[model samples]
Structures are given as C-alpha cells and as structure tokens.
Target: MIQTEIYNNGPVEVAYQVYDDFYHYKSGVYYHVYGDKPSGHAVKIIGWGTENKVDYWLVANSWSTTFGENGFFKIRRGTNECEIEENVVAGLPKSSGNIIGGFIAFLALIFYYMF
Candidate 1:
C-alpha cells in the first residue's frame, strides 16, 4: 500500500520504531533485527528501488546530510520491516487551478500535524 501510494503520489510520511542500532546507521540498506525498547521516529519515503538483489525503500531522514547516505537511507522493503509500512500518510493538494490554492492545501497538511 505504501509503495502504491508513492508510485501514484509522491513522498509518503512514515512513523517508525527506532532501535539502538539506528543511531549507528551510516550507509547501506538498514535492516534492524535486534535491540529492545524502540523509540518513535518519523521519516519520509521518497522512493524505492532494488540494490544488490535487495529491495528497499529510499527514505529521507531528518538528521541532516551528515547522517545516513546524505540524510537518506534505504531500508528493507516489504515484510513490514520495522513496522515502517504501518501508519503511512500521504496527501495530494486539491487542484483548484491556481497556485495559491495548492499552497494553501500544502499548508493545511502541515498545520494538521502541528496541531
């Protein structure tokens, strides 16, 4: 479902459970298999592709470019890896044939999350 949304829409916001190993993440496909007491974290999955026979979701993290793969990382796709597939949210601006309307829609989404 997340993949489908990305294919049709664009980036999708996803809330994930972060474990201890996530802090050490630097490069390559991230697949957390162990650790306990995961904290909540959110990231945007902009796209997906296969790498070295491994399917992954191209995710953009908020930790800045100094973090994983220039602030982006690939995580094992499918199988609900780290429950990332769950709690997916996506929205499309209602096309009112005007730029202001579109911008308002975008702002509304931000406000929805803020409040």
Candidate 2:
C-alpha cells in the first residue's frame, strides 16, 4: 500500500497533459505540493535520490521508461505529495521450497539438541 496527497489537479488526468504525451521527453526530478485533499490514487515508490544537494523520491509508473525518466519519476521528498508519505506497506518476499527445506532441517537439529 502507498499514500500520497490529494490529486486536486488529478495526476492521472494531468500527467499526460503536462508531458504532452511525448515519450523519452519526460526525464527529470519531481516535487510534491502540500495541501488538504486526497485523490485516492496510488503510485509505487521505486527509490530515492538527490540532485544538486536537494532531496527527492523516485516513483515508478506503468508507462514505459521511454515515456518518463527510464520508467521512473522523482517527486519532492518529505512533503508527502498527494499524501505519498503516509500509510505505506510492502509484502514479504515469497520463500522457495529449497529455502523452506533448509529451515526445516535447521529446526530439526535444534530440536535434537534440546531433546
């Protein structure tokens, strides 16, 4: 789960318009605008970065990398643009059969020592 501020300007509706639908032309850092409103939209936070000593957050978009900064975009850090800074959640990685088997073996050894 992710959080961001209200898209009063409606990001999904405005991003294309702002970039003019030009692929490979939208490459740059992004910033957040602070205010009271929630658009109920979600975007994945890919990474973090800093330019010229300024902080920012990296966002991943469905549009191909050619569309925007290698399929990613930067937004203002710490401001929670569109409430992005709030209520974030990530899932644990899936375990493979081999890993589970190894864990089970380790547990068995521990049990043997205790008994």
Candidate 3:
C-alpha cells in the first residue's frame, strides 16, 4: 500500500485527476465524489493520520501557502480518491550526492508530462 511506502520511505509524489472541488478546498478531510470535470495535477504525500475517525493522507500542494491549510491538505485515505494512489512515484538515493539529481530528474519528468 502507499501508506506502507510512506512509512518505510518519506514523501511520495502522486499524479491524480483534480476537480473543481479540489481547487476551492480550504480545510478538513477532502473526499472527492462529485462528477466535476477533472484535470491532471500532482502533489507530495508527506504523512497520514486519522481525524474524527476518518483516515486521511496529509499532502503538500504546489499551489503555495495561499491554498488549503497553508499549502497542505488532507484527503481520504485507502479508497484511492481521485486515483491518487495510482501513479505514485518515490525513490531512495543510493548516496547523498544522488539525492538532488534524482529529485530534479523526477520533477523534470513530471513537469514534462504535466504541461
């Protein structure tokens, strides 16, 4: 599971389909279920927790602090909401030197397809 990956590693990057509700999201656990048209977007899943019995994944959005919860938001976990669980990418560098290069390559790949 993605949660397992996060526990073993660190943050994971996920590419998912975003709807109108996601753009306007402010606070609380977000669970997307409407039929609004979706566009491709990506975010980093940094952690997870349960709020009021609702399991959620804490994510860092690229949209900046003006966005949801100071650039972080919680989404429903385990259900693959917005197919966020799909297209997940994570890697552990073999050495400290490779970390920056590896991450830059990953971001370049993501931006290549996202734009």
Q: Pick by TM-score: which candidate is best? A: 3
* Model 3 Cα shift for residue 111 (angstroms): 10
- Give each model a TM-score: 0.77, 0.47, 0.78
Please give the TM-score that candidate 2 achieves against the real structure: 0.47
What range of 10 consecutive residues in model 3 has the weakest lDDT sum?
A: 33-42
Error of 3 at 63 (Å): 0.5
**Candidate RMSDs in order:** 4.7, 16.0, 3.5
Residue 2, model 3: Cα distance from true site in angstroms: 1.8
Q: Mind giving the per-residue lDDT tens digits that candidate 2 earns over 1-115?
A: 1223222211221121122222333656554323333234345665666877767666767766675677777766666544456534332235533666645654554453344
Model 1 local distance difference test score: 0.81
Model 2 C-alpha lDDT versus the unseen true structure: 0.48
Question: Mind giving the per-residue lDDT tens digits that candidate 3 earns over 1-115?
Answer: 7878889888998887787778779999998856585588878999999999999999999998999999999999988888888778888668656687767867875885568
Q: Which digits, one per residue and each the tens of the lDDT, describe model 1 over residues 80-105?
A: 78788875767655664466755675
Model 1: worst 10 consecutive residues (lDDT sum) = 106-115
Which sequence of candidate numbers ranks them by lDDT, best first? 3, 1, 2
lDDT of 3 at 89: 80
Candidate with best lDDT: 3
